[model samples]
Target: MNQPFDSDLPNIDAPAIGPPTTDPVPQPFEVKFATRVDRLPPYMFGRINNSLYQKRRAGDDVIDLGMGNPSDPPDPSVIQKLADAAADPGNHGYSKSNGISNLRREVASKYYRLYGVRLDPDTEVMSCLGSKEGFSHMCLALMGPGDTAIIPSPYFPVHMYGVILAAGNVVALDVADSEMFLRNVAYTCEHMAPTPKVLIVNYPHNPSSAVIEPEFFVEVVRLAKKYGFMVIHDFAYADVAFDGYRPPSFLAAKGAKDVGVEFTTMSKGYNMAGWRVGFCAGNSEMIRGLGTVKGYYDYGMFAAVQIAAIVALRETDTNVEKQSRIYQGRRDVLVSGLRRLGWDVTPPKAGMFVWAKVPEPWASSMSTMDFALKLLEEGNVAVSPGSGFGQGGEGFLRMSLVENEQRLRQAVRQISKCLG
Candidate 1:
């Protein structure tokens, strides 16, 4: 028989004896993790991302439509402003943890101009590294043991994991039907013992590209008042939409400021994804809670970036609108191309993704993860499997609109041949 792995230890692989030696055998120490760390699952995108990297290193020109990262450049005026601000010695120092006065004011002005929701920059607004960071820190600020957050099914990963990381529980409600989603929210709140402590909303939701109308938040505010739950609306895609369909701000609803805050970012609409300029507005009390957590955790965003952000918000509205049109064109190409492949897909009204249903025999024969792998390995196209979002996302694919129209068309052809 083969020897055991511990055979090098004294008497480990030898026959047992009546008496054993008293000499100590050292054991290799292992790093331990906290219970909190144990709560998280492996990153679902790691495998796909790693494979893409490996293939690229091997010199494959993979058509990457897996991530919603913006590929376009920021307005030249914004870039010039950033360079000018960065050159000033005073702008290099640590910034105010709640963001500089002018940046917050600019965010407030945008909200009023866009949605007619007036805000006090001093008390009701703060900047974040990105909306993702703001959402996570807000979870830490507001959630705790025994707290529960109601999130949408087929969710963006952070919406679910952020609450989990704060030692809170989650209840996901399916969001495919906007009306049914609200009804389920009411039903969940009415039944849960402690009721849900928070309700997280993402209109123009990620992965699924589900968009909600303004009246949705009116019902949300009413429900929150009835059940005493706080609301956090992730409005990351606030500035990106198609077909003249403007995405409404949650705070635009009457009494919304009494129950919730909205999170918006310049990433999608401004082609400033790398700048990490994000804002949280409405509900001063909630802002204070988030600001308190941030005080200990960060030094706030870079002042130069904040200055550039101010210029973008004030002067780049046209550029933001143009970016949305570009995404609309790309969406047309991707959705039409996928539909031609006999895939069930819809053109999204807003957001940067086309949530599509996996087609026919292949979908039934293999897991979504395997199907995605097949596309990468055989078709040289990278995609995100729906199951990565949650079980509710199974049998679907979330294709991002980041690639150019030509590249997306190429991806569709490759997908066609791979399945053929």
Candidate 2:
């Protein structure tokens, strides 16, 4: 052993292996993410609500009014179409990523009949797995680093998050009141960075349930033209209005096609959330942009689902009208019950959620999360806190009308008791 000893060699009889001569184990790949993703706050609402659901499963009689997931089923004809299509052996295959031509044509025809907005099915209409996916993909296709998107505050999270995911900036404008929404848009054009290349709008708005008029849309079109920004309107709840006040179509505005596109979903109107069928119509260029991006990503929705959606669009209006009536009745019941318990709640004119201001004693000390947590623990009633939408949503709560009139009344009763 001593004849030609090497300095780096370990003795043959060394009691244990010496420290391994290798670089430290590499950190997990997940530890390194895009800086943009690292900047996002944890999605607290979903995290907390999921935990609450587990608790409720453990014997609590929880009345969940938190999510806007529809509890109803599609019409008989729609279901029949899905069944019929599925029964055909030849129907099982990859679908057209841009959507079937017949489905696109049906959507265009419906648009013309309902809103008087004539769309070229082949050029301007494209189907989506869902409106959410369509909107997100559209953002990625049209926006990029250094670009800015204008979003209304208290909006659906997808609108803002999509821009962020695309590595673009968002300028949140408050649309709590109709006048304020218009004012903020005009003001944003004058003051935002990168001059805001895109503007996102929603009506029969989620959380606030605010409906915009044709005049407001005209103003939006004018701004889009002047500022050279594309307008994307999410009309998911387009057919869910009440009290005889139909929401106006952005496509109905004079210059809408010059600067705008609108998204519609079967999820809200036909209870097809699980099916995930939606369509985008308007602005041929934008539609093509979305389609091109989607083509590289997915094989499109299932053929049977697309076929069923055609039936849903053509035959489900009556079901939609009935659902709207039921929601209206529930809204009235819940509003009256809350008012009787000394909390003022205005009935929403559209959409499925009631946006209510938190009451006095807790309003001062309680953040939306705190209030929502207390409600879940103390009253066994789950509601979506306002701050989940955005900063401007603080101090408010969104109660979904997905529950029945009896369940909504029960939720109000529980809240009343908890307050006392």
Candidate 3:
């Protein structure tokens, strides 16, 4: 046998690399990102708002209706709870990955009391840092490359983008009208590649503010069962509806737990956006799947935040109702004001947005981004260009009702001055 070479022998005497070559010619990285990642847009939301902010800072009085951030404060009780919990010396450590048991139990209790939806808090509920994170993780956990997720268009961009990020294809179903929305979903089930493994639905919808009724849930649950697809209902705006219209919980539908999961967040209802607290409840299997994925990724929301969220869930309904009323008042003012200026803006049924079509003079001549830029430059009104949401959202704009009624009225007045 050939003498075994001393593989471990260090070649210390080999040419003492002459003063380490100064920054060798930067070689092109041959290790490329996955094709899917390379295909993604460099930025999701464009630099429209940042540029508008700069312009506004330069003396333009921009009434920002671009983002659906709540301008109000959380309930005093909730804030006090957070403060008390934060003061506890022992609460600062890493939290449980699935969230504190107390929060989950409280969530289950609230669900049962409000929707008559019985849930085993241990298995059916998982607290999330936010509903958006919960939704995104669910898509990743339940899907793989070549899988398909049925998503409603002119809806939340995160739903579609999350599916795409998971190497899954999104079958966009336009939820423009009630009938067409349902039919599109049914059609997707009947005809789609890889047979759509997941379906995402958002009620008290963003941008559109369309509230889904119990009948819609019934149809959704039926389609889910028939097609054997997991349904993920985003109830982010569940507590934000106005005019006594209590939005129906997806769990209220019979057999909903057989194939669905619903995500609710404190961000909208309790103005806890920065707190990052939310919960997902429904089909135990889906909840477990999401929890499993999250366990691998995070240590859950902060313990104090979860404790504070428990307080919020238990005591913030009145605050939520008050916030809803405020938005409703602002919506009424903005809709009437815009209409007075000859722009037909439909008052949203729920959520914090007013989706309005671009007027005739501008609609045909300019894209949503172009019109939005022009409006920002001339009127100093910062509305979200609809095309940022999706292609179907083109020729429209989404104005958040987060501003006060006076500010909304002023925004409309500015628009009138610009357009007139």
Query: Which has the greatest lDDT?
Result: 1
| Better-scoring candidate (lDDT), 2 or 3 | 2
Tens-place lDDT per residue, model 2, 310-400, is 8888777788999899888988988888788877577888999888888888889978888988888888899889899998889888989
Q: For model 1, where is the 10-residue window of minimal lDDT? A: 4-13
Per-candidate Cα RMSD to the true structure, in Å, reads 7.5, 4.4, 4.8
What's model 2's overall lDDT?
A: 0.88
Order by TM-score, highest first: 1, 2, 3
* Candidate 1 residue-wise lDDT, 1-420, digit = tens: 766667457765467667656867979999999777899999888899999999999999999989988999999999999999999999988887889999999999999999999999999999998999999999999999999999999999999999999999999999999899999999998889999999999998887989888899999999999999999999999989999898989999999999999999999999898988888998999999999999999999889999999999999999998999999999999999988877888889999999998888988899998889999999999999999999999998889999989999999999888889
Instruction: Give residue 12's error in model 2 in angstroms.
Output: 27
The C-alpha local distance difference test score for the whole of candidate 1 amounts to 0.92
Q: Report the number of the highest-TM-score candidate.
A: 1
Clashing pairs in 2: none
- Comparison by TM-score, 1 against 3, better one: 1
Each candidate: what lDDT?
A: 0.92, 0.88, 0.86
TM-score of structure candidate 3: 0.92
lDDT of 3 by residue, 1-420 (tens): 645568698665567667765778887779878876775775535667687769867977788899988888899898899899999988999997788999999999999888999999999999888898998898888988889988877868888788888888888777878678888888887877557898888887777787767899999889888888999999998887777788999999999999989999888878989888888999998888998899999998778888888888888777878888888899899999988877877777888889999998899988889888887888888888888888878988999988898998889888888888
Query: TM-score of every model?
Result: 0.94, 0.92, 0.92
Alpha-carbon shift of residue 101 in model 3 (angstroms): 1.0
Clashing pairs in 3: none
